[model samples]
Target: MNNSAQKPGLRERKRRETLQRITDTGLKLFLSQGYEETTLDAIAEASGISRRTFFYYFKSKEEILLAWQSGTGAAIAAAIQEQTADKAPIDAVLDAILSLASQFDANELVAIERLLRSTEELRASKHAKYVQQEGAVFEALCAKWPQARRRDSLRLIAMASMGALRLAVDRWVEEGTKRPLAKHLRETFESLKAELGRQS
Candidate 1:
């Protein structure tokens, strides 16, 4: 078997490299200069691509920010799929989210998040990102536990889980703590569970 046949061809590899370069250059400019202030020409120039070439990779500058959010959402979904079947669905989702949080460089996330909230347009995009992420989590859970009866419960858990994560990240960013994001996630989950328990 020619396993080498499965490898990406030169064109595909080059495409991926160019895409990465654009994303990296765009993000750097977005973070260093404010998102609205950074122009497309600046990103294209920094990436060594033509302005028209930038449109081939992304429809708009906002798409670049969403691209970063999309990657995080996919990572959460991937982590959810990796959870063992025996664990409670909520716990599995929590662990997956915690794992994702643990991987982030706290300072980098703080900067990115601040940028996301810097303008009205970006704030709307940030909210949309959360909605998309919640959908991703729900879809991943439904895949993991295929029982029809569990659909509604899984949806609820996904919503609650994302809520916990949002609260955790907000507090973590507000405090600008050296403490790890995972710790904030754990505490947020604990508080959520405790509050729910009180209601029950």
Candidate 2:
């Protein structure tokens, strides 16, 4: 009912459409010409946008591949941070991962995985993003587990849990995500905790 409200909504829609066009066009060119061979100029031209506009959307060619992979871990990190004091660490970790994985579209995740594997740079970028995300999760977990008898035990748990997440992602992609990623992650983390708990 408000003209000004509708104007912002229209602009947001236009921005999404433009970004999608750039993403789609850039991805297509990367595949066709090869990831290392693709150029921003070609991508911008194909997307019917100026080079400057493409730069505004993506800082570099590798950024397009990194974009989808970067922000994904934030949800899991935040979920872990918000766990109640009474929640078991294992349950909190699994539930955080499960919450994030459930929000991803499996099919699209598969495509992002494919693109991520295309170059060492892209894979490294993905790893770097997850590393920062893991650091954040670990800090949040340390604060939550204040009564931990040994600080090293909490650190080990954080390291091992994040490692399990990486393995789950690998399995999820290799299996083409036929099953829910949340299930894969939960089972993997549960198994890791059980195995490690026995050793501790």
Candidate 3:
């Protein structure tokens, strides 16, 4: 409903920065004290923002955990929408995902993986945020495809593409940064394509 849900400097870069601060602080506390042990007041205090200010950026502690993925997921959705209409939907989606991975620091990602595995709540939060992220990407793809092509086929492909990206990240973290993350993402996307083809 609110276009504020859309991102980047259309307005309030300050807001995004504040959200990041809250997210970083919240994540650190979650990792250190355990998610269930951490309180919102502690997070707000750690972020150096008032409790009211914290609520202005996010509704609850869960929203703080979702914040990091939300920002990156928005960017990935925008990238997919930027692709030319000539490309196939799968190519457009996976290429956008790969490009995003190119900008990522593999070491930093591994650190996040460690953080996510730190608590049961964090692990569950990771999966929940991913579902939200996929919904965002799927909506972007829905906007880009031709009306005639925007059927079950497109939705299925979008779901599968998100699944491929998730698997790519899983393998990337598990592999201990032996190779570039972008390469791993691309490879996973290709593997997904082949598997889908086989089922077709």
Candidate 4:
């Protein structure tokens, strides 16, 4: 089948567009005004949707904030898949994560992280997001190296990779470093490798 035949229909496209608009509007308001200060009614108005319509796309403002994080897992998964098969699994995952981190604008990331940290609920919920990312990375690794015996090792790599990423982000944010996030990610991955006695 052709790509067009596989693509979403017009109605689906419209729904996606509307959903993105709402997410973008909410993120803008949250970043500029403050997450606690932004209201559901304000997001609905800014997105050109009724409050009821907003509910059709998301149940709450927290969900909208989650939406701002939507594509990252898939991007990481894709990056892992794109790595040359000759590379070791750990190296591939490290490259994938670094690529993703490099794409993020440091200032915007700081703003978004601040907004997320502003709410106790968001901070708690964010762990679930990391878990989801680990799953994505694990699946991608398995697809690339499908030996059944490797499954356990792949799972560990996924978990450890995500743990390192979280540590890097936390330190980067706390220090307010002007350095690029990719640098932090690389350093974290190096520490991870060293802790494992340089075993890939």
Candidate 5:
């Protein structure tokens, strides 16, 4: 795998900037005209990049959506690792997820979620990307607990925590309520924790 950081040069920075511009332009267009209606040529033209350059950054229309999640996954994993270094692995994982959830603007996320729900292809792509992200989070936890044998348990806990956050966000979108996303996410996690404690 090519490490973007180690590939130092002016050209690399220019390439990154171009990719960002293309992605930003494509997202804006997708939001304005539904994702299905937006064309790659229009995105390339809007971003002032050639069609070839656009293809260099992303292979297809669906790939742009995947790219956003992939880019954010790395940041989320790092945030979790940094914030949860001193805590129990499960607590750390939940805290990390909550932190990532807080970064989203509710309206923007609701729109994106609506777009994702509207297409089977997008739903599959998003789910696959999330599975990959879950693996990354699992790896980060394993790094922190190399000798721990309960890997499946930890993964299940992480998935459940993430699922709760997802459901909360979905409810917020569905209700069109004015509550902050972080509050809902935290409440969901807390409720899950209480339920688990009761079962035990």
Candidate 6:
């Protein structure tokens, strides 16, 4: 019985490693040759995996680019729950977003942003994914604040916070600035708060 459980666990670990290898190789190729120019076959060849195997891991090249963020929505939701136990709902969500942003390297994020800007298909797919994640975050926020009955308001707040973070990172990357992502993120949050205060 234990062996049966262990078999599945080991298989899953190996599968995750294979998928990561494919994604890392694909990103490198995409960054070098442009996302559209880098084919799935090239990614498979670079990762030493068959094209069929690559398909088993990801349905398309765009899927591979956004795969990390797929399951991450749920993780973000959970992080918000844990981190915001005693904090205000919006503050908790902002903290979670900042924490999540810290998970990736600055170069990796700049590369991903560049790919999204250059690829219309990826932009559409990424937008859809962001909408889905926004829904998840909204649900989590509602759970945290039972009186927060306005879903649209929560979503707008989430979107605004995300937009601020994206702008900060984009500026940082464009200027070749070297700063911790968390610091940029905190500054973005502070700027948003200040802007809101000015309007009020």
What value of lDDT does candidate 5 attain over all alpha carbons?
0.77
Q: What lDDT score goes with residue 170 in model 2?
A: 92
TM-score of 5: 0.85
The residue-by-residue lDDT of candidate 6 on 44-115, one tens digit each, is: 999999999999989998887787566567777877877746775567877887777778777877777778
Q: In candidate 2, what are the lDDT values of residues 21-126, reduced to their tens digit?
A: 8877776776668777888889899999999998888899888766545455566667887778687676787788787777766776677677788777777888
Candidate 2 vs. true structure, TM-score: 0.71
Clashing pairs in 1: none
Query: What lDDT tens digits, residue by residue, belong to model 3 across residues 1-200?
Result: 87767756634787777878889898778767866798999999999999999888888887776677787789989999989889988999988887787786666667767777777877898888788787888788888985865767877877888888888878878888788778877898889889888998
lDDT of 2: 0.77
Candidate 2: C-alpha RMSD after superposition = 5.6
Q: Give the Å shift of residue 71 in candidate 1.
A: 1.0
Model 3, backbone clash pairs (residues 3+ apart or across chains), number = 0
lDDT over C-alpha atoms for residue 150 of model 6: 65
C-alpha displacement of 126 in model 1, angstroms? Answer: 0.9
Q: Which runs of model 1 end up more than 4 angstroms from their true locations? A: 1-17
Q: What is candidate 6's CA lDDT for residue 67?
A: 78
| RMSD vs true structure, all candidates | 2.5, 5.6, 4.2, 1.7, 3.2, 3.9
**Each prediction's TM-score against the native?**
0.88, 0.71, 0.79, 0.93, 0.85, 0.74
TM-score of 6: 0.74
Candidate ordering by TM-score (highest first): 4, 1, 5, 3, 6, 2
Q: Where does candidate 4 stray beyond 4 Å? A: 2-5, 198-200
The local distance difference test score of model 1 is 0.89
**Pairwise lDDT winner, candidates 3 and 4:** 4
User: What is the Å distance of residue 54 in model 6 from its true position?
Assistant: 1.7
- Identify the candidate with maximal lDDT: 1
After superposition, the stretches of candidate 5 with alpha carbons farther than 4 Å from their true spots are 1-7
Total clashes in model 2, counting residue pairs 3 or more apart in sequence or in different chains? 0
Model 3 clashing residue pairs (backbone):
none
Q: Between prediction 1 and prediction 6, which has the larger lDDT?
A: 1
